[model samples]
Target: MNPKATRWAKSVAMVATILAVSSCDVLPRSGPTKREIYAGSVQREGDAFVIAVNDRVTRATAVIPALGFSDSFRNAGAVAADVIRPGDTLSLTIWENVDEGLLASEGVNFTSLDSVQVDGAGFIFVPYAGRIRAAGNSPEAIRRIITEKLQDQTPDPQVEVRREAGDGATVTLIGAIAGTGVYPIERPTLRLSGMLAAAGGVAVAPESAQITVIRGNQRSTIWFQDLFDDPRYDIALRNGDRILIEEDTRSFTVLGATGAQSVIDFESQTLSGIEAIAQAGGLQANAADPTGVFVFRNEAEEVAAQVLGRNDLIGAQRMVYVLDLTQPNGMFMARDFLIRDGDLLYVTEAPFTQWDKTIAALTGSLGSVNALSTLAGQ
Candidate 1:
């Protein structure tokens, strides 16, 4: 055989040998795809941390709606006006018929009554009326009572009454508010919006604000966005109500394979799963496994049991919620899925990426062998 042919044959044989050896450790074409991570033996059910595998349609229809609580308060009007209480200040003016001929004192046709504050016993002492129960009575009702009492002495007296500054209901504002103090409810129609306005508005943007109302023994929280989205959330304020405006520093962490991974603050009070992912710069198209998207959250014991489909009550469950973005309705379900504070969203690497990496390494060795063959042939 010719020397050149002999060399070419040896080089071809060497190349075949390298390829055969490399095939031993080569990545399997497709042993198990990314979907196996969700259904495979690695992540089976009955573990301490239950994995809830929910499709887009099931999550969007059932789980998403159950995540949020209903708004409890309603619009009852600001400064509950009909009820008067102790500590209220009242001002009165008295006038008698000047034309009456009876014991009407010449110099005293009109009297400017002294301003009175309702005592702890719910009574206010007027000069002639003396120890009137003013706490539960409206200003108009008080005026009538005073006028009727003074009619005999002053002759068909007319009385006018007005509540002083401390007479009406008020809401106390605190934390991240322009003016953090007690503000009087000036109108009967005053609402959460109006009360916030009276307090000089919020120090931060509404999207990043949380409003909490402390009424009696119960406390309720509402996102600033929800307050803006629905008029029904702008409920009326009551006396001694404490309105706390807090900056929403709550956030979630993104990990695994994504465009950006960090603990990101929610720009608004409430955020959907899709919005949260977008905030984190979305998933990396090349590295991310769309079927292996997972959200890790430590849910309440009862809620976790219900979500995990467990009958017995267990401890606080750390839930791993899986969503398959490869489906058509994935994005729609994500839009409805609410992301809470401290949630960890992870996009596992695609299974084929391993194969690609392995192949690239094999190709580099083949290139080196080809270069050596070319040198030998020369």
Candidate 2:
């Protein structure tokens, strides 16, 4: 064996070894394939989660009530428009008629008393009346209380109270909302939806949008859509209620030969195989190998692999599932297969094609080099 020949033989062997490792399809003999596991075809027999075509009814129907304003409005209390705040100024006025004959005949006459501003403590110091707590009470109510207090000293006292400065009420909106700020409370009562509308509604990311209401130290979640659908759930906004709209963070990734390869935002919920594919833009023409489709998942050391083929899953009883796409009817089942987060879907290509191309390229290169050497020698 010449040194040159030996070197060429070694090079061919190395290339062959590379080809061997990269070439053939490796199928699991005892367990389900990755595609079967992903498709959920392999599962324990009689498992409650695994339902067969026969078990699924064709025309299952039920009446679902439409979401409406009445539903949201139900049980919701009326919210006051004006929310009282500090630093607001109020005016109190007292009026009485006095005879004028006193000045003309050494006597005085008066028709009304001067209006006075209420102090910071909501107290009004009158000529004869003493200090009084008037905060939080309505203007009319305050007038009646003050008039009664002054009745003992002044006869027929007519009293009036009016807001002098500052707004009557307000509500605060925050978090994932289009517009968040302090909104003036106008009416005597307002609903949750009204406040949300004033704050520019909830800013929901396509899938999960929720509004949270915080009263005192208690918290409650409200569905944004539900507010429009069911009036019963629409809550009343109080003076200091904090409304927060938020977007859920849980999401999943869809990749490979599907139409779209991106992260899908979901509310940490289960997804079916068909739904996942649709989210990824459906299957690609050349990229998807229906029979070779696989899903890889793990439970402790026991890894489950699903293989999808013609129309039926091979091991429909185990945790692993096999979806058969060869038949036209298989699509329906594929759509029913559920998918979970962190699950990887691989669409396999036809076997031996890559190997064939690699070998042909190497042989062609060798032939071209040999021909050049022969020409140079000649």
Candidate 3:
């Protein structure tokens, strides 16, 4: 070979060797690789506590969001529809055998007194039945009282009473429902589930729906599906109750060698690890290491103790859970494992990915060198 060509070859070989050796350490990546993570977390002075994922580990960490009803909410009883209240509008009709009746016209046998409203004192005044207590009594009981009082003036008189639109028997239905406004409590809609159905159900997915009942100073929330799954959740609604339905607001952060690196909202009340990965658009097949998936969280001291099987750890401890998809039970473990709020789910790059980057860097460096050599020769 020519001395010049030999010198050029030697220079190119030295440059390629340097580039290959430094590519992995200097190259920009989405996140740290598995080896880097292991090196950092394996030491006693490490910042995070890393645990291998398994059946027992999953059981220890499978926690659900806090959602349930208190006794004050679950035990709030209902009011009867027949019982009259202040501010109620009463419709009354009177009937008599005689053509000229006390409350009827000359030829008419029956007469209707339209919209006789109950006073704030819970009393209604009829033609002959003066100051009747219509608030505490049902319509049938009030009708009988009116008939007895009017019989002296108009013999064998009959009375009918009906209750309509009152401030006393209504509730406010708001948030993620089709019909959001004040609704009356009567007939078929006396319970929580019935009122929800009357409002056209939840506007979002059933799994993501959450219901809250606010009764004065007390407030309680539960999964919307739980109202039907458990009868105890479907407590009787009371007057002036405010019911709200909305989607859950919990989410997790996805990073590293996944198809997407972003914040993902939970799809349901109970979100599985596999479901969370799928929501992140899955792991990047070209660069992801199946055995290096990890979940990082700041667990409560009590939860940390349960997870580590040792009560010595104190305060809020940082935890990392590893999931190896290569094992036979790995997929099942992932399926059963639960993802929680504010968690970090990451997939590491394959070891070969670093080497590939090194090789590509060397080839690119050689290409530039060859072009420079040709220019010099010219």
Candidate 4:
């Protein structure tokens, strides 16, 4: 080879080396490389703590978002339908066994008392029964008392008491329900689940359905499916309860070498790490580094301490949990691992993927160099 051609060959080799180094930065990759993430996680306190996921890590990080009712919500006893209270209107029918009965007209055998309102003092006035305690008693108890009191006034005075207006026994249902309105707490709709059924169930999917019970100043949210699986969550419905039904707000971000990259909503009550990846279409076959999957999350200090086996971490800690799919127990670990809300699932590109792109860039650069050498007639 000519001396000039040898020089040109050396120049081309140097230019290719430079291009390979610069190509990685300019390449259209999904996210950071495995080495880059490891480099960034070197400082454990200020930066993200890089922890390789295993059985211990999976157990430590398996925290699922809790859905439950507080003590005030569950302990609140239900209102009785039959018990008479203030603002309740009672209807009384008095019957006598004589031709001219007392308190009844000249020849009437029965006299119907309508719109008989119970006063704030829990007493209702009757013609012969006098002011009786109607608030704390049931309809039957009130009827028996009235019959006994009116027995002397008329011969065989048969009395009947019916609750006409029970305005106190009611609950309001709103949001993500087929029927969003106030429903009376009848015999059939006394419990939380029963009242939801009476309101036509939840409008959203069962997995995404969430019910928030606002009783007084205290409020609690629970998952819809928890009623059947966990009986303790289905609390008793009380009067003046405002129930708001809506969808669950839990999601995770999918990025890097996967089939698709986007924010995915949680589809079930609990989501495993592998299940979440599958929902995002799984890892990219040709370019994904199976051993370099990472889950980035902002873990609470308590959980972070448990995960790292150290109690020095404060407040919310940044964490990068690594998963190596090449290992024997990697799949099992991922299956047991749980993905939390706002977590980022990332898979680094294969080592050869960047190399392949670098070679393509170098190959293109060589063509232009060769053409320049030809024009110079070297």
Candidate number achieving the greatest TM-score relative to the actual structure: 3
Model 1, 54-119: lDDT tens digits are 543235323321211135457354454645578777777777787542323566666665568888
Worst 10 residues of 2 by lDDT: 54-63
Q: How many backbone clashes does candidate 3 have?
A: 0
Residue-pair clashes per candidate: 0, 58, 0, 0
Runs off by more than 4 Å, candidate 2: 1-129, 150-171, 184-189, 204-207, 266-273, 291-378
Model 3 lDDT per residue over 1-378, tens place: 476886877687667667565757676577888877777673656788888898888998888877899988787676787888887888998999798877788889999998898888999999878989989899999999998898888888988899887766788999999999888787677899999989899999998999999988889999988998999999888888999998988999999888889999988888888898899988888989999999999998988899888878869888999999889999998999899999999999887887787677767767777776666666
Candidate RMSDs in Å, in order, are: 7.4, 9.1, 2.4, 3.8
Encode model 2's per-residue lDDT on 1-378: one tens digit a residue.
Answer: 466765676566556655544543432122333333345432433321222221131111111222232333245567433222344456655665444321122243332333444446665554556676655666677777777876776567677666543433556788888898876554532777777777776776524677777767766775576666665677766566777778765455654456666777654234555666666677777545566544433321111212211234234223323345665766676665555545555444433433445566657656665565455445
Please give the TM-score that candidate 1 achieves against the real structure: 0.65
Where does the lowest 10-residue lDDT sum fall in candidate 1? 60-69
Q: What is the lDDT of residue 345 in candidate 2?
A: 51
Best by lDDT: 3
lDDT of 4 at 307: 90
The order of the candidates by lDDT, greatest first, is: 3, 4, 1, 2
Which stretches of model 4 miss by more than 4 angstroms? 1-22, 43-46, 71-79, 98-119, 125-131, 364-378
